[model samples]
Target: MREIQTKSTSRVTAQATDIVLRQTDSIRLIFRPTIIDNVKNKEAALKGIFLYQKKSKKAAWEDFETIPLSSVKGGEGYKLEIKTAELLQLFQELTQLYELHQKEGVPRGQKRYVQATPQLEQLASLSDSDIHSFSNANVAVGTSLLSKLLVWATSLDDPSPLIERLVEINPDSLSKLNAALGMQSLKNALASWEENECISDEEFWQESLTKHSFVLEQVFSWPTSIVKGKAYVGGKNVFNQDGNIVDFLLRNRLTQSAALVEIKTPMAPLLGAKYRQTYNVSTELSGSIMQVLNYKHSLQEDFQSLTGRSGDLFDSLNPQCAVIVGNAGSELDDPAKKKAFELYRHQFPGLTVVTFDELFDKTRQLISLLESEPRVEVESDDMPF
Candidate 1:
C-alpha cells in the first residue's frame, strides 16, 4: 500500500486529525474521530468528500472534486474510498474543460473559481504549533505597544491628534465630544469664579463676559451676525455732559444701530418690601434699568456729536437697553408674585430684564440638549433666551 499524506486543518470546533490517503487499486481516506459532541446526528455531519491537488512543489493547493460521502464508508473511525483510475480520468476531463473555457473566454454571469496564492494558502492552513506560537507572541507585543501609546498620549501638550483620530474613526462622535469639552470649560470658569470670589464684583463680571462673549450672546439670544462694540465708553462730552460711562455698547451688523447693557451682581435683590399691600421692584433692579435708559437718552440727545466722531455707529432714535441683574428667588415662586413681575416687565418696550439664574439655567439646558441629541437642529423659537 502506498500512503499519501494530506495536511489536516480544522475550521470548526470538531477537528479532523490523522488524515491519511492509502492507494491500492482504489484510494481510501481515513481520519480519527472528531471531539465535537454538540452535533445531534453524527451521520448527518458527513456532507461530501473533497479532493485537493498540489500541481507542483511551488504551486498552491486546489480543489479537484467534491463527491457524495455516503457512497463509501469504513466503520472504525471515518473513511471514504474511490477508484484511482476514475479519479485520474476525472482530472483529465477537468483540465480539458478549463483549457476550452480559457480559449473561448468565460460566459457572462458565470464566475470561474480561482485558487489563492501559496502564501495565502499557507496562512489559511497554519499548523497547531504555529497557532500557539503566534498567540503567545501577540499578547506580549500588543501589551507593550498599547502601554507606549498611552504614555505618549499623556505626555503630549496638545490633544488634537487624539481628537482627530477619534473623529476619523467615528464622525458621529464629534458633537458629543465638543459638548463634553464645553462642559469642562464651563466648570473651570465656575471654579475660577468661586476660588477668586469675583462673582460679586461688577468689574470682574464685565471682564468675564468681554473675554468669553459667546456666553453673553447666548444669554441675550443675539445672532452671531451682530458685532459687539466698545465696553465702558465714556459718554463725557459726546453723549452726556456728566461724563457717565456705559458698561457695554453693542451694534447691529446690518443696521449699525447701538444697544446699551447694564450688569449687576447675582446677590442683588429681585423684589423689595411690600408697599400698600403690593410688591415693588427692588432698588437694585430699578436703579440698573434707569441707568441703562439714561445712557440711551443721553446718546440720542447728543447723537450728532457722537456720530461725527464714531462714524455714525449709534442708532440714537431707537436704541435698545437691557439689564442683567439678581437671581429669581422666592419672589418668583409664588404665582401672584410671578404674574406681577411679568406685568412689570411688559411695561417696558425697549428694555429687557433677565435674571442671572435664568441665564445660567438656560445655558445648562442647552448643554444637556447638545449631549443628548447632538444631531438635532435647534430652532430659534425653542431657545429660552
Candidate 2:
C-alpha cells in the first residue's frame, strides 16, 4: 500500500491508502482513498475512487485511469462506464473484494442486517441448479427463500440492475408468472378447505379469508367492475368509532363503490325443512344475508362522515351485499334444494349469496381457463427430477 496526501483549504491534511483490488495479465485496478472528512465539502471529501490500468504491466504501477466515485456510490443519477470487457471483469472483482471486506468489518453493536442472517448466507450459497430445485419444495421453504431475497433486495441501493430486471420483464411474462402463482395459491386453498371441511369455527373461515383476500375477489363474477381491496379496510372493517365491524368492506377500485361481505362456517346449512313445494332457506344463511345488508345500509348512511374523517374516498351508492355460507357441493346435491337456494338468493335486490364450495369452484374454473392451451406431454421416464 502507498500513501497519498491531500491538503484542504483549512490546511488540514488527510492520507489515503492505494490498495490494489484486482490485477490481470495486462490490467490492474486499485482503490485509492483520497480523503474522508465530510464536514467541509462532501464532493471533494468523497473523491476516493478506483484507478485502472494506464501503464505497462512490468513498470511501477503509478499511472492509472481514474474511475468516477459515483460508480462505487451508486445512485439513480450515477452512470457506471466500463468500456471494455476486461475493465468490467476488474470492476466485478473489485466489488467482490469490497464485499469480502464488508463481511469481515461488521460494526460494533449491530449484530446482523436481518434476523435470518445465517439462513440468508446459506441461501446465498445455493447454486442456480439448487435454487431451481426449490420449485418442487414445500411452501414454507419457498416462503423462506422469498423472505431472504426480499432482505437482500432491500439492502441494495436504488436503481439496482437486479431489481430493474422487473421492468424488462414484460406484462405478458408477468401475467404468466401471476397465473402460475395463482394456480398454486388456489390449490393450497383447496387443500386447506378439505382439511377444515368439518370445522364449524367462524373465526377459522374469517382468518382464512383475511390471509387470502384474493379468494374474496373470486366472489365478484364481473372482474372488470372491481380491483383488489384490502381484506379488512380501516383495520377489521371498522368504518366508525361505534366499533361496528363487517367481515369485509370491499370497494370497486375504480368507482370506489362499497360492498359488504358476511361470512358463516361451511357447516352452516343452506336449506331448512321443506315448506309447500320448495325448501326454505336455512335460518343461518338468511341471517347472514340480513347482517351484510344491515352493514351495507349503515355504511351508506355514514359514508360521507367517514370519508370526511378518514380522507378516503368511497361511494356507498347502491352498495352490494354478499353472504358466503354452507357447502353447496353437499347441500345442493339435490336438484330441488339447489333450485330453491338459487331462487331464494336471487330474490334479494342488490344482494349476492355464494356458497363456500362455489366460491373456490370459481377460482378453479379461472385457473382452468388460464391453462386451457394445448399441453406438450413429456414421458415420465424422460422427466428431470
Candidate 3:
C-alpha cells in the first residue's frame, strides 16, 4: 500500500507485546503490562486465567484448567505456571474451541457467560519452546487466533478464562487487526469493480472516486489526504467566479499544500484519430488536463483568502493538479500508441494525467501485496514453552 505522509511530528510507536511462553517439564507464560492496561474492563483482565490443551499435533484442543492470577508475582511482568500434561490438554481444548468458533462465525461484543460442560472449577492447574517459532507467525494471524479464542470463550456460560486472557492482549493488536480487515475490504471492492459486466458512467465514476479518494492518491502518487469533494476553488459559495468547483481538493497533511483533481469516465478516449499517421492526445484527455490546471490557478489565486478563513489548510504557492480520465483500451493497443500516451503524460510538470485503468491496476497491485508480504513479527529473548 502507498504510504501517506502524516501531519504529526512524532515517530510511529511500536506495537505492545501480549504473551510470551516457555516449555520444559512445566509450561510458563508471561503476560506483559500493556495487555492489562488495554482490556475492555478491569474485571476481564483481573479474572483467573484458563489453560486449554490439545491432545496431539493432529487432534483438537479441549478445556483443561483455570488458574487465578491474583497470587502471581511480578511488577511489570506476570508469570503463570502449569504442568506440561495439563498445558497440552488445555492447548488441545483451545484448538477445538477455535475450530468450532470458526464454523459458527466469530461473535462480537462483551457479554458475560459461563460454560455448562467445561465447568470452570472442575480443574485449577497449568501452563512454549520455539521463541522464534511464535515470532515467525504473522502478527495478524496471532490477533485472529486470539479473537477466535475470545469468541469461543464468550459463547460459553462462563467466559472468565477467555475474558481474562483478553487482558493479556495489547491494544496495538486491535490496530493491526483493523488494518488487516481494511485491506481485505479494499481488495474485495476492487474485485467487485473488476467483475462488473457494464462499465460505469461518468457520474458513477465521479461518485465512486470521491468515496474512494485513496485510489486516486495511489494512482497519481500524490501522497496527500483528500480535503474535500467538489471543492469550491473560488472560495465558499462564490458560484459567479469562473471554475468555481474542482472535482476534488487534496491537502498535504504535513505541508498543508493543496492539489486539484478532475475526474472523467473510464470510457473516455486515450488517443484520438491519427494525425499525419501518428497518434496524439485525445481531445477528452487534453480537455481534462486543462480543466484541472484551470482549477489549480483558481485555487492559487484564492489561496490567501481560503487559508485565512480555514487556518493554513491550503498553500498558495506550488499548487498541483491531476486529471484522471480515459482508459487504455483498443486505441492504445499498439506499443507505439502506448508510448505516445506515456510521453504526453510526461510533458506536464505540475499536472498529472492518469487513466482509470492505471488506477485499477495500481489498486490490484496493492491488494496482491497483502498476500505476498509476510505478516509482521516481533522477536524477544523471553523464554518459550
User: How should the candidates be ordered by lDDT, best one leading?
Assistant: 2, 3, 1
Better of 1 and 3 by TM-score: 3
Q: Across residues 63-134, which tens digit of lDDT does each residue of candidate 2 receive? A: 645455556653445443554764665455445334423453212221122223576679779986888787
lDDT score, residue 84, model 3?
Answer: 86
The better-scoring model by lDDT among 2 and 3 is 2
The lDDT values for all models are 0.59, 0.67, 0.62
**Worst lDDT window (10 residues) for model 2?**
106-115
**Residue pair clashes in candidate 2:** none
Identify the runs in model 3 with alpha carbons over 4 angstroms from their true place: 1-168, 171-176, 196-200, 235-243, 373-385
lDDT of 1 at 377: 72
In angstroms, give how far residue 59 of model 2 lies from its true place.
50
In terms of lDDT, model 1 sits at 0.59
Which lDDT tens digits does candidate 1 get at residues 44-66? 33222344343555554444555
Task: Report how far off residue 355 is in candidate 2 (Å).
Answer: 0.2
Q: lDDT tens digits, residues 162-202, model 3?
A: 56776688879878877887797678658755764146476
Backbone clashes, each candidate: 0, 0, 33
